[model samples]
Target: MEEKQIKTPHEVIASGGNVIKTRDDHSLILVGSDGTVLNSNECSWISDDKDNAVDNKLFRSRIEPWLTSLFQSEHLSLLCGSGITNAISSLAGAGTGTTMGETTFTNYKNEIVSAAQESAQASGREKGNIEDQIRVANDLLRGLKIIKDQNAAQLEKELNSIISNFAKSILNSENGIATAEENKRENAYRVLVNFLLSFASRTGNKERLSIFTTNYDRLLETGAELAGIHLMDRFVGNMMPIFRSSRLNLDIHYNPPGIRGEPRYLEGVARLTKLHGSIDWIQNGGEIRRIGLPFGAKAITPYLEAPGLDNANTMKLMIYPNSAKDRETAEYPYVELFRDFAASICRPNSTLVTYGYGFADEHINRVIHDMLTIPSTHLVIISYNDPIGRVLSFYSESAHKDQMSILMGGNLGDITNLANDYLPKSAIDRATIRMAELLQHRMGATSGLDKQATARQVSIVADVSTSEE
Candidate 1:
């Protein structure tokens, strides 16, 4: 990760408009010291003057500090949505941008199509993608089964095709990743690693960071591997990992002397949970298990080509293409996943920093709302745009307005900008803290320095210690 100085949004705009639909972009205003708000791309107040251009230090000075503090909370959780995949995948050929995309099996039933269209309009979109279709399909699938209709089989077949194609599109989007050591198209993987490390680089004293994502892709896991980050989930095994319901709260620790008093937390370890399940996961003999599904492989081709596998192979994948919009959390595994999410963040002094999440899942949103009930818990959302205005709407309607923070628009939401500029340099947090203590001690030894003077010295030292060489 190259360290870049804090520059203005325009100067630091290294990414494309991958996270689009900036309808609520202006909802979160960017203000500078002059009380000037920049609602547009350029800063009119400073653009004309060569030396007076508005640097994005306004965001750095404001948002970054809060994020730094939040990331250091005793309980820190990160909720990632499709926007992250959209941003990172954009680094490769044409980022698919939030849509699961279309499938060849578009011949959806009349009711399913109608429901999708209505759902699309409700979300302020002209049309819905595979997700909308699949969600409607799930609703119909359950209804058909309940009534014991003869048409249930046909609908199930169509649903399978839709889901398989949907999975294919997701795999295709992940082509940005590079498995070959020498591959040039590895920027996506690098970004993924940087993003994960930003959160995974936590202090040993605090609990392991909890990461919950709605994406079915395996980008996070791959990135964790590349970054040498150990990710712990419910699944446990060597050959085949089984999803256990127990909250073992397992973590990685090491004895300071390699054998002594209360082991210390090892760095670069995190707890991961795919809130919507994962592409590599499947239900086998009533137990959820994970398989060796290669990341970025053509979705169902490998399975179909295997010696003993058939077309039904993809069917076994545990990924259910639904966001539980209608409270579908009651279903198996998802209920447990939501329980993990709730337990992770719905505690005192918990801070959840959501990136690329748009508050689309009502079930997850409900837990977040409950988390906010804890006065010490905080919610910081960084997103491309509030397409459906849900992010902004949630903030305005919440009684705990003071506990929430929003950073929207492509300038701040893009993954590259986020890594190089916004998110706290977790690597330097402890160093800065230690240096501050040393400076305070040295200053106090010299004289009865005023509190203001001592603080100024400590702040300067911190800036120097963390700044890129």
Candidate 2:
């Protein structure tokens, strides 16, 4: 009998298994039917081996037919997950070890150890003091009580401070956002934003642009503003935008005085909905309000304050991890926000393109599945790893497979690049013009790119132009 050859991680996943990365960035382990490690690569998460790249390319080519179907749909919505945010930071040379996904227990553990060591040395305490602090952080990470001789309250405060600082680092005005990154070429956030803007601008005036995000970070908002695209979020007014669910349904229009003048659309290319509440959002008198702060602020504390209280509202309004997330969504603004998300997905002729969002949120997963029942609704899920649960089930089902496309082990650049290429001529043209305008801004030129240059770039790359050279 002939012996079988060892299969790569991608091959294992393609043959119906999962490729999960271990915490230590050690290996790409393949999980089997019974949830056991069937195989693993003693290498990086993104392998540089020729065989892996070839397999990825081949798999992508095989999925082109499905991609075509998704692109041809009338409406498009995008879901940005933590994975894509990490990709943005990595590509932008702005990795502060502080994106949403990097704020895990493991990362926090290391941070705690370093801080404890420094504090002990500065206080001239014995070496064992550092070790004692280390033990506290480890116990907290493992969901256990602090060891004897350590103050529980102190340890808890330290833990919270570490986590809060990590989140704040990722949200810092200077280096936090993905849009602040210099290079637009490899920046996934820029590419995704451009794709969203293109679809929203070129689509029919009545057709709504739906963008829903589970992340609390401002990557999408930052990118949208830099690109001169307006997001129609529930919050209105510059100082403090009050959150009203009804406002999401409103649209901005401009009507000229002349009888023959057609009403022109002014703002709101997309309905930017953050299902999970943001750091800037605060609860005031049973309602949510967006607090605007000056750039380069130190922390979340000094900015948000309850009425007539000396202390700041220290409650960070973010839906942190799983299980607890369900409970959090039941709260004030989240309930209203999620309701809009579900409604948007259910709309006829709507298509949602999800990036990096693992179908982990059960509430969101259920609504996505329910939306599929609508005949014209479509879903395109693109993630760095194989999708789990209902996402996998729906992708494998032959009945609705045509209406859905699941591209695993793919980057945001890949999905956006292919979709932009496959979009209709009108969308591609509009996107090219918009991209050219952005490029001109980057060059510090006062005037916009001429139609001749815009048309040339639109036909070629959709984003790149001769002026960029």
Best by the lDDT measure = 1
The true-structure Cα RMSD of candidate 2 reads 13.3
The lDDT of each candidate is: 0.68, 0.54
lDDT of 1 at 43: 32
Considering every candidate listed, which one attains the maximal TM-score? 1
Poorest stretch of ten by lDDT in candidate 1? 15-24
The residue-by-residue lDDT of candidate 1 on 1-469, one tens digit each, is 1212323332222222211111123234443333334343533333444443334564555556557766767798999988887776667544553355543443455767788778766554566667777777778878889999888888788778767776776777665444333343477677778888989887666688999999988878878999999999999896667899888678787876766686767989999989888877766657777777677775554654443233335666777744535456667888888888888899998999898787766667778999999999888888876665667667767887677777666666778777877777866655655665677688665445544333423433443344322
**Displacement of the residue 211 alpha carbon in candidate 2, Å:** 0.5
- The residue-by-residue lDDT of candidate 2 on 407-434, one tens digit each, is 4443323445444442334444446567
- Candidate 1 contains a number of clashing pairs equal to 0
Off by over 4 Å in 1: 1-28, 31-53, 101-108, 117-128, 142-150, 179-184, 258-261, 304-312, 324-327, 436-469
The lDDT of model 2 is 0.54
